[model samples]
Target: MELITYWISILPELGNGVINTLIMTFLAVSMSAVLAVILAMGRMYGPRIISTLCKWYIEFFRGTPLLAQLFIIYYGLPSWGLNFSSFTSAVLAFGLNSGAYVAEYLRGAVQSIDKGQMTAGLAMGMTKFTAIRKIILPQALRFVIPPWSNDVIYTLKYTSIAFLVGAQELMSKAKIIASFNFRFIDTFVFVAIIYLILVLLLTLFFNWLERKLKIPGFEIKN
Candidate 1:
């Protein structure tokens, strides 16, 4: 009863945290998506130097943990004269980390397209670059949708790490509340429920999206 009362009274604070969380997640994912596309393209068709750089980027980020990266961004960069606010650090770290995985998924999708597709476009008056832009990418996007959705969901969960860097997202809100009220159990239980509900809704949305976007005759498994 006491926990319930406290929760009711503190709901507004938590609500603000939710808004912050959503902002972080959206910004991070948007940044990650753009970087991911560029990295994916670089790995797939760019010159050897571009491909090597892209490969190194993906390997470095995916090879390491997100928490470590967040810490380095928030704590370590100041020594090098690169400074960022808490929220900026979180978003930058999460976006760069997520972009690596997204690049791999997109690159795989791009590679799965038949070589003949590009060839056919080239034979029909399209330049190689035009053939890639007009012919290859369109087909690759369909195959990437499912995996890309997974990355989005992962990014939603990843926003929790922002709080550790003092970004004031949902997890940070819960931590502050729990410390003040000394109600760790109740606070975290509620937080877990909120996270669970969000993930469930996202999963359902992706499922619906897959069904809607799936073509009847196009076999996407490559």
Candidate 2:
């Protein structure tokens, strides 16, 4: 009860942190999703050079630790006179990092789509780009949803690291509260519960989306 009381005392500060965390997660993940779709499409259909460059980007971001990537962007960019605010740096780094992984997920989804669907669109005199835009991507996006939901959840969790880069997210605020109270365990437990609730809400939303969007013919058989 004492621990709960301590947490309650800092609710206002923590609520602000939660809002910051959500903003970071939503902006970063949303931006990453857009970039990922473009990269995935390019890798799937573009010329060799474009495809190669996309592959390299995916590998580089996925191979490195996100903390290291954040540090590099936040700390390393200042030397080139491209100093960014911590929030901007966090958003940029997280978006780029998550984009690489989302690209891979989208690439696999795009490939899993039936090749005949592309051919059929071409046979109907559709340009390749038009065919992809109208036919291929719709199917691929449907297939991507389940995995992409996981990506969204992971991205939300990863936003915790923004605190290290001075973004003042939920975890960072918890750390501050803990420092003031000298109650690391209690403060962190509150943080954990908040994160768990956020993740659960996101998961429920995705599940509902899956149900709403499921195609009768394409429904996955459990």
TM-score (all chains, Cα) for each model: 0.94, 0.97
Output the TM-score of candidate 2: 0.97
Steric collisions counted per model:
0, 0
Single out the weakest 10-residue window by summed lDDT for candidate 1.
Answer: 213-222
After superposition, candidate 2 runs with Cα above 4 Å error: 220-222
Q: Which regions of candidate 1 fall more than 4 Å away from where they truly are?
A: 1-5
lDDT of 2: 0.90
Per-residue lDDT tens digits for candidate 1, residues 87-154, read: 99999998999999999998888888888998899899999889878888878878888888889889
Model 2 lDDT-worst window of ten:
213-222
lDDT scores of the candidates, listed in order: 0.90, 0.90
Clash number for model 2? 0
Candidate 2 lDDT by residue in tens digits, 8-109: 898899999999999999999899999999889878888999999998899999999999999999999899888988999999998999899888988887
